[model samples]
Target: MTVTEQTFWVVIPAAGVGSRMQADCPKQYLELQGKTVLEQTLAHFTHHPRIHGIVVAIAEDDDVWPTLKVNTDKPLYTVNGGAERCHSVLNALNFLKDKTRDSDWVLVHDAARPCLRREDLDKLMITMAQHPQGGILAVPVRDTLKRVDVACIIEDTVDRERLCHALTPQMFHIGMLREALEKAIDEGVLVTDEASAMEHAGYSPLVVEGHGDNIKITRPEDLALADFYLASISDEAASDYDGLMADDG
Candidate 1:
């Protein structure tokens, strides 16, 4: 793969079984539209000029491998993820460390979030360049906020306007993230996200505003919405390409 000088590497942790999706296949490998959810994700990075290569982190005995339809010519490397999300990411980082220098950029994206928008991703890249630390894509919370007690009742209405929902393609300088992961492992810190880990280390990650349609495919109903988004995207791309071809002809 022609990894551009400024190219960023991606680590997709596909180790989770995704029991919430209630599908026989692991959620990442499940077909959406004409492509697998994981494939749709790869399409984003593989086609991007700034993305150099990809390292997919999967389980050791993963059953989803045989069914995937990979199109990128870059070699796919596999590593067994730990029981937790941070562990899986650290394992992927260790694998990537052998291939890249410490200063390179690494992006950790969720495998289930196939409905990710291209524009949002490009925004993240631009944000990272201007950012002092690093950045991730996220959408501001538009709805009213609430802090519920253990009884499932609302304790108070928090300011929702200040809250933002974290999404993926979370980017960081390679060495910085690796150091954070190492500290997390030694200190037994089970961080919820990469941003949290960075925060733990006293670094603030810039949040690039994302769209509502950049949905994470979590529940079953999300799959239906994913279908609609995919069809619309395909139609738009086809029309755009046809116009370009017409002008060329």
Candidate 2:
């Protein structure tokens, strides 16, 4: 949205090992609905008319390269990821940076997030188109909050008025993103996300409300929910994964 031209590139960082999900397979490769979660996630942007191309950063040992059975291979570029998620993203940008100009816009997305809705993407783009600052997809925190000490005892109920959960396809001007990431790297500063790096470089991003259904399939219950969501959609829109036939223990 903020990036209007043809220079917009979608960069997906799928290098995380998903240690929190406790899955034997990488979280992105795990099946949701009928397709691999990453495939469903890619389907959203791959079909977007303005998206110039997609760059997927997978771990060197990740089986996603082998198991993912996608056919539309136009703007797809594969690169090896680094040790940390930020490093993986920066590495992807580094490779893409040479192939792209500094002014190109990069939409950094998480491969594990497959529940992203089309309307949300359009909303973000439209919002970004109106702003000159960085952009983030987020929703205001609606639940009560509590702060706990190191021993797990509730320290106090912190104010929830200003809290919001961060989501992706965080979009930034490619050259600016590269410079910010490079600065962090040079300073030996490890950032948790691209927006954080941009913020550290002194840019405030605008947040847009996101849908609650747009869930990340991180746990087994999440997988079940994704399956139902996929079942409701048409077959063509959903991806089929024969690899999951061996999912039963």
Candidate 3:
């Protein structure tokens, strides 16, 4: 089937209290570009023609999500999140079990990662449309690495070759990812990301290269960085539109 013919869903795990940000509320609720971080993240997928629906796993006691004015005509759902991100993702998958088939694709993204580039997103969907094992957007490790001991001493310089910084919108088949997450949780293994769970299931998902501007808001300073990235993206879009107009003229 063509990429547009396939059903695609987005799952956002927004349950964690980002203590690192040291904010009054959850980092996802923090203000950025005149909207909550989560709001900005949701905007990326809400109007995308390829995205069929969205399921957001929010904290059970999250009172802030209700206050946000999100404008979208697509199917947007909210489920009570779990103690861990894996459980939250599984909950979202289970929530959609009745509505989606085993082959339907689901892209799990972070709520605070609001700066995903349009080109990177388009690349992921187009490249992984027919792929048996779906892929994730990642950037190759460019900096020197170090292995440190508990004492803060650098024991060895690690090789950066073939190493990558995993970014989000990790696309996977619904049934496959659900089963993989269930297996990892049952085994008491701490699978950090969806890719890691799939890895434990013996599937080497493809890694589609993406830009590094897709940053997760972890610290207070990240708000500024995301603001900058968002401005740059807007400027680039405006420039492209101007060029198109010039060509038409």
Candidate 4:
């Protein structure tokens, strides 16, 4: 099917407690730019014209989601998350099985990643809209790498030429992804990301380049960085708006 004929959906896995953050609640629930991290992350898709719907996988005892003020006219649903991120994604797929066709696209994103740029999202959609395997937003590895052993000693300098940091919003066909995840999980394979599951199933997914600012909130320092990025993004938008008004006048 063509791009316009395809329906795009999003799945957010937000059940993790984020023990690394050492916070009172999950990192997704932590306040960022006067809103929860998950809320900020959802805004990118909820306000987008191409997104058909969204499914958020929350913890079984997650009471915070109901209390949040999420403004969206699009179809939004929630399901109880599983032990791991892959399990949660698979659960979301199962929830959408009856509601979507096999060709419909599913973009699985991390709830903690709140700084996904609009251009990156569009690039992923435009590039992979009709692609048979699907694609993801990623950035090239710029920093030098070191292979450390158990004693924290550097064994060797790893090659960074072909390395890329995998970011969220990994897009794929709904039915195909579900089958892949199920197959990987059945054999106790560690399906870290959607693309890995697809790879295990013998499909080469496209990798779309994205900005490095799209970061997952993993530590306290990251919260500060995200806030700064959000502020910068707002300032840029305002400047662009002023420029547009001046041209219109």
Q: Candidate 1, residues 1-249: lDDT per residue as tens digits?
A: 112235578888888888899988778878887788888777776655567788787887987676776766665677888787888888888888878887788889998887677666666765585455787888888888889999999999988866899989899988889888778778988897899888888898898888777777888888889888776664322133233222223
lDDT of each: 0.77, 0.77, 0.90, 0.89
In model 4, the worst 10-residue window by lDDT is: 236-245
Model 2 — TM-score against the truth?
Answer: 0.87
CA displacement after TM-score superposition, residue 147 of candidate 2 (Å):
1.3
Report the C-alpha lDDT of model 2 over 1-249, residue by residue, as the tens digit.
Answer: 233443678889888878778888888878665678899889887766557888898989876577667766557888898888788788888888678887677889888777676666766766675567658888888888999999999999979897888888898878888888888878888988888888888889888888776677777788878776656544433433222212211
lDDT for each residue of candidate 4 in 110-215, tens digit (9 for 90 to 100)? 9999988776777787778768899799999999999999999999998999899999899999999999999999989998899999999999999999999999
- How accurate locally is residue 219 in candidate 3, as Cα lDDT from 0 to 100? 91
Q: In candidate 2, how many Å is residue 68 off?
A: 2.2
Off by over 4 Å in 3: 235-249
Give the number of the best model, judged by lDDT.
3
Stretches of candidate 4 above 4 Å error? 234-249
Clashing pairs in 3: none
Query: Distance (Å) between predicted and true CA of 61, model 1?
Result: 1.2
Q: What's the distance in Å from true for residue 191, model 3?
A: 0.6
Q: Give the local distance difference test score of model 2.
A: 0.77
Q: How many backbone clashes can be found in candidate 4?
A: 0
TM-score-best of 2 and 4: 4
Superposition TM-score, candidate 4 onto the true structure: 0.93
Q: Write the per-residue lDDT of candidate 3 for residues 1-249, one digit (tens) a residue.
A: 767678999999999999999889999999998999999999888877679999999999999999988888999999999989999999999999999999999999999999997677777887788799898999999999999999999999999999999999899999999999999999999898999999999999999999999999999999999999998786332233233222223
Question: Which wins on lDDT, candidate 1 or candidate 4?
Answer: 4
